[model samples]
Target: MHQEKFSKSTRTNKQVALHTDVVVVGGGLAGVCAAIASARSGAKVVLVQDRPVLGGNASSEVRLWALGATSHMGNNNRWSREGGLIDEIMLENLRANKEGNPLIFDAILLDKVVAETNITMLLNTAAYSVTKESANRIESVNAFCSQNSTYYSIFAPIFTDCSGDGIVAFNAGAAFRIGSEDKYEFNELLAPEKANSDLLGHSLFFYSKDAGTPVEYKAPAFAYSQDEIDAIPRSKNIGAKDSGCKFWWLEFGGILDTVHDTEEIKWELWKIVYGIWDYIKNSGKYEDVENLTLEWVGTVPGKRESRRFEGEYMITQHDIVEQKRFDDAISYGGWAIDLHPAEGVYSEKPACSQYHSKGVYQIPYRCFLSRDIENLYLGGRIISATHMAFGSTRVMITCAHGGQAIGEAAAMCAKLNVKPKALLAPKLMSELQNRLNGLGHGLAGIPLTKSDVLLKAEIQASSTLALAEFSQQDDWLSLAQSAAQLLPFTAGLAPTFTVQLSAQEATTLTCQLRVSIKPENYTPDLICKTIELDLHAGEQTVSLDFSEVELITQYGFVIFLANDKVQVRTSAQRVTGTMSVFNKVHKAVSNNGKQIAPPNSGVEEFEFWTPERRPMGQNIAMQITPALQSFAVSNLTNGHLRPWLGSNAWVADLSDKAPTLTLSWPEKQTLAGLRLYFDTDSDHALETVLMVHPEKRIPFCVSRYSIKLEDGTVLMTEGDNYQTLNTIYFKQTISTDKLIIELSHPAENVPASVFDIEVF
Candidate 1:
């Protein structure tokens, strides 16, 4: 008899100990974004993902759609595209993965993370253990890879828990909650009446391919029969045309813990899925799926709910539904409060309940940092929020935004040698916002007051540009009703209104500048002044000089006479908080690819209104300085990106002549390089495949340009450009007090526009 004994020893060379400024757990979109944000901010980030691929649920394994503020433009929130790392990801996906192919998307995310110089990506590494310096701070995370048989000990100044399950935080004893919270606890209307451990459950989606011939499907003995799934509402929504996330409701395990009983839930979902396919193929019920066969099914379920790490601020349903503005808000969400029934697909009810907001809402900095844990920052689905609030925030793009915000904060904290809580300070928070905006992450309500050269410089432009334009359907309505557009203005600022008017024939138009006595109600109260204009049949910019009128409140109402002799400019492109009011024209008007018609008259004013074609967000077409700042060339120097919603490069008047922008400074500053941010139709989130997409490109981007500096230096002469941010580095230090930029017509032959320009 021989006794065999196996000796265990560390792969002396395989044992790896790596130190970084930020260590991010989980390689989903959130973790990847967090790592990228931190790395871009000059931190060495070590990204650890348990899966072989990135994107988590959005990967090929789960094949979930990466949705965010766009939310398929389902309801009130329109033209809202996520920015920051997520926007970058969407842009890359649209460029490379137009067909919504998961494999290609996986490669895009992987390539993005790898492209960052300071990011070290560790794939197939699962964090199972944590080392703590104190009860409230994590020292390091220990992870193991079964594939490579390697043990990794990663150390960092800050740790981001983007793991959907919050595994690292759980192991590190970070404060957390599981399942739904009672309504009474958070004063949330959507919460369950009583606190319970029931979760939103897991979903297993399947993709099918169509063969030339019929494909037969057989059900396993354990699969459900037709009668077994009678309670499900599949009959109403299911169809052969559906693929990818179409079968997302084929879920179960709400009664069981999502994490504790994952395998059991997965098996049940599999049986249900196969059973459904069998029924469709053999039952002779769904003729459309006759040639379809199951090509792939997600074994690891795409989870909807799980452990949530507690943070200093717990986002509630009220904050989301009411569109609450938080001073510390770092990111925004507008997917709607989508809550699935606890019984999941088997509930015989709608898969989910959705309540949309009027606009995007904020997610504060406190939602990312752990309430008690000093170094831990929560991200993705694990961010501190009541289950009711998570319904909207759980979407991948919003999660990615949160990840980016936390990553930037973590990097700043590491640089400053401070804790995650330190960023909550007002000064640091403002700095964080500036950094985010500087990186072109569009936070809707946050303004780029700092780092905006136009704010301090004496700015002038080639022309007072109109970001959007509207056509006149009919000039005369034959009604006495009035019309006005609600504009959000600062109380102290003297706002100017540039009304673009069009007429069928030469006619006169009268408009009264009215300020709402009740700021919230938009009722035309005291008439500040009345302006009469004589206009031709073509488009013209009529200046309603409200610069003399100091707005008493944030909103100043502009009332128009219902003569209908001339039509005012209106577009579907909606400004965030501003709206257009038509007393009688209740018919919905389309603007910016969205419907802008609000319902009939309300007792109070401003309740039902549409957005003008002018602009929204920081920029408006009305040509108000410090108010509608979009008309200035300095908008090119401001840090905002994603040109739609009036956040864009200043567009010159449409003419045969090219427009020139000159940058003049007081001192002769030596500049090394020039960064040009051009408009690339950031509004549409251009997809790689435009089979069903509306716009291919924004058409306003500057595709061709010429630049000449002082002292006979021709820099970037006649350069053809197609990117969002184009950098032209000068070979030598060009010492000058002024530089000139000539933007020629784009390839599309539209007006030349530039979003931003920077010299360093």
Candidate 2:
């Protein structure tokens, strides 16, 4: 190669022009999901990411865990995992990289993107400019890749900005808000008394490992002095065993512009990180840190709040706290309204203030569409939400769930040859919701419609679960705190529940039968009945009969008040739609047993009844006088998935051998695909990082299954399944009058359960 002669003028970099149906900006979990969903929905997609890897805050560079509605299962929301593409990604990560290694997570995301043939992924490319066709619509986006010295001009009919900072929409002239709104503006009591410029800050994390010998560290010139470190109110929280996001409060630059001042924030965070490390190694405060060495430090800080674009509707604090239902509901969120102080690590105030809602609230499609730029779609933290509401919706997985909806909407827009606003029509909105729910995207209160074949078929199962008893096992748990067994009930007289208990001495146990004010919610806010039981020193059975009280069809909590002297028997058996919850606090999320908001704060006060993590959260051992027959084979055609008004899933009895479900139709029908929904224990929080899950595969998820025709010819078989949605497309259409699905129990104790089955 020869060098060119020096000239007075400069040469331009290589330029490339591309066209696609949908263009998704940013490669965070939200954008990654947006691109994948768009590609799966039959749209050509171009994914542009400024970083070298996907999963922005969740990437190795930042190393923040991807969390959403489940809120680490620290709140009242049960079976509340966000579904669709994000769920698939999390399950895949759990299968291959249960250790939650950041590097492994990055590879998994890359693998998922590359597997989608309809998607064109561009890494290390940042979109900096937008070209508008008119005053409202975007014609193309201009981006550059520093590594390749290339400029890319991508044109698309629809554009989705999943960038955390709303870069694309901002450049396209989209209206946005930068700071908290005034309390009177939206009548949101949680809002600041007056409009403020303060915002959540950016944070950096570091990891350490044992070196087995003394390791020395020296503070750099820019590092903070001991006095400066001492100024931080939470400096005492720093410990030798903690790493990564545990120090999420180690933030800075909230008082400044998060987007423009990111560099300044990074430098300050670095100074703090290195300074903290120096103190641990040389300050001689931490004895266990003698053999520890710094394993890694984040190169970039994880940004919390930035530019929030305006859409057709701006979700306010009321919508979240009141569990408002939207006519254009497309997705849902259950994480608490978590907000941090502007002073961050240096503040004397608590690290964060979080308030949880009574239940999961619905998010409308209108919030995802930009009001100013016609073709623009806002996603992630930049979605149309006020500062108070964004605190709950800004989490990565929640944003990813909304991103899937945006991607599907983009596909619909291209198909209909219309703008994002046009989807607001009632009929069109219904279509969008139907399409999203069909793909296993969880929308609160929206049930799937039965397929034509399922509508005409008669479903029968080999055996169905009758809630007769949970046999008492040797395992007995102490009543350290109040514990309750969540059980489904019919709209009639409450059944008699007999529980086995043992006491150190004679003790009186107070039992209360409670239900949520809303039937679909899990929070036990309404007391249905109460009973008093006397326990003996030895193991004895106590019967609680609420026969005098009539009840509506919903989940009833059989609560036993805390009595340290008594112990309740627990069964090892795991059920698909059953769990045991306790009234306790998860200090990690600021849940202090119960929430008591300040007067006129507009936030409701409620007790947090959360479940214990698995390998320990066993069901209570109890027997029903008249066995509850709710898990019928007919539930497969009931439209609803998951546990709603009742157990919508068809669960086979644990005693049944070779469990099978048969669907017979009057006439032969052509079938090309079959979709099965299994129970993945949605209540369990499958956190994407830091926290280690008790099991790689959800204990209730079916591990092996087979589909066959009436003639006993096997159509397909999945041997190592570990997901909620299983779609099996046949190589060729088969005409059959009857279909038989043979299932294997996920475990010996756990029964075989399925939410819904669709044939097309």
Best by lDDT: 2
- Model 1 Cα lDDT, one tens digit per residue, 1-760: 9884675863343679999999999988899889999998899999999999998988887888777765553333434667767876776575555567788888988899989989988889999999999998899999988788889999998999998999889999988888888878877766767998877888888877898687778788988886665546654566666665767777678888888889999998888887777776777667677788888877788998889888899998888866788999999897767767777876876776565555678899999888888999999999999888888899888898888999999999999999989888999999998778666677765755443333333445566454333222223222134567555454565555665666777877787776645343333456788888787887777777666776654455676776656656544333323445554432211112223322331101122223222222112224444444344465565555543334345667555385878777776777787766665543343322112343323345576776777565677774544456566888787777777887776642256777666666
Hey, what RMSD does candidate 1 come out at?
A: 7.3
lDDT of 2 by residue, 1-760 (tens): 9889988998999999999999999999989988999899899999999999999999999999999989988999988899888998999888887778889899999999999999999999999999999989899999999999999999999999998999899999999999899999999998989999999999999998899998877788999886788677879888878988888889887899999999999999999999898877887777878888999999989999999999999999999999998999988898889989988888888889999998899998989989999999998899999999999999999999999999999999988899999999999998898888788887857888777777998899999999898888999988979999998888888888988899999989999999999898898999988888877798888898988878888898999988999999999888878889999989987888898897898999888899999788889999987888778888887767788878888999999989899989899999998999999877777777787877789989998999999788999999999988999999899999999999999889999999989988
Q: What is residue 542's positional error in candidate 1, in angstroms?
A: 18
- Candidate 1 residue spans exceeding 4 A from truth: 1-14, 449-459, 466-630, 634-649, 680-696, 717-732, 744-750
The top-ranked prediction according to TM-score is: 2
What's the lDDT for residue 147 in model 2? Answer: 95
Model 1 TM-score, all chains together: 0.79
Off by over 4 Å in 2: none
